[model samples]
Target: MTVEQNSAPDTAQIQLTPDESIVLFELLSRWCEDGKSPTPEASCFESTAEGAVLHGLLADLAKQLIAPSKADYDSLLNGARDRLKGNWDFPTLRG
Candidate 1:
């Protein structure tokens, strides 16, 4: 569990593994490419404070991630997804 810390004491820091960063970068890139609200409600991400935070997060992720620029980005994204999903398997039970 390695984390890269920021020297500034005033700001908060969130740490993500390489796989997590790659997966997040791909998701954000898709939202930007589509130019649509991530949710059905336009207000959810149009011009509100939540949207602002998302915008900032996307920018920061872009700076930290390089997988999006690679030719095999899709493969990388799939691999990341698998890693993040881990061993959690959905199960069905009869009532």
Candidate 2:
């Protein structure tokens, strides 16, 4: 098996029914929209910033769902993760 395949979490395999599938997709879409622009100019649903971001998220999650490899996943997210970690992870703002 490929390294990417191995890194994926077992939870990713949970079979969602059609309804549940749509719910997850919608949640991801709304999340991207909230993070992106709520009034984005893209006319096509698939062409919206939310769509692109959500696509990337899904692709990355597919590659490394759990126990992600540093080189493949953590490395890519390191900067953002590091930047946000201090503010969100710690109780105090003191460095």
Candidate 3:
């Protein structure tokens, strides 16, 4: 029997502000607890309070992006990209 290890990196590198770190971790933690991954759309969504809040957040972000009229439209767009950026992964983050 034998064992081997790979030393390659699997994620990417990017940056996020302190607030983004908090929000991104919270969001990922919730999905992970349910054994789910965040997708552009959640197919297994329920209409419960928490589920509704999650869906609502997605919808609001979408609406602002489409209309571009909201005060924080640009910031919102950047925040999403920053949060889900590849660097959010552990190895890249810790590095």
Candidate 4:
């Protein structure tokens, strides 16, 4: 089979939470160890202690970083686009 045949398109749309990011990283580590791809069934990090921590972190990060209003989300997205186009430097605190 060709490289294209072996690789699959990413169809899973996940609204990532910080905790989920950690669990996802852990599972990816395990998959790498086993020399296997992470399947949908294996992708779930719902039960383990680490998974719980990950979920909590994600929830907190979402609450802190994401805008509660649609307008805020749109503004943030527009700002991001402008930054990507080199129109503005991202706000960074140097201290």
Cα-based lDDT for every prediction = 0.75, 0.51, 0.52, 0.50
Q: What would the per-residue lDDT of candidate 1 be over residues 13-66, giving only the tens digit for each residue? A: 999898989887767666665676464367545557776777789899988788
lDDT of 3 at 42: 51
Instruction: List TM-scores for all candidates, in order.
Output: 0.66, 0.27, 0.27, 0.28
**Candidate 3 lDDT, 1-95, residue by residue in tens:** 23334655466544655445445544644564445665435555554666666655545444433323557745764776676676455664246
Please give, for residues 16-76, the per-residue lDDT of candidate 2 as tens digits.
4433344344445455545763533466465457667667765644454432333544343
Better of 3 and 4 by lDDT: 3
Count clashing pairs, candidate 2. 0
Q: Which residue window of length 10 is worst by lDDT in model 2?
A: 17-26
* lDDT tens readout by residue for model 4, 26-86: 4444544345665335445555776556556545544555342446654554555444445
Q: Which residue pairs clash within candidate 2?
A: none
TM-score of 1: 0.66
Clashes of each: 0, 0, 0, 4
**Candidate 3 backbone clash number:** 0
| Colliding pairs, model 4 | 17-58, 18-58, 19-54, 19-58
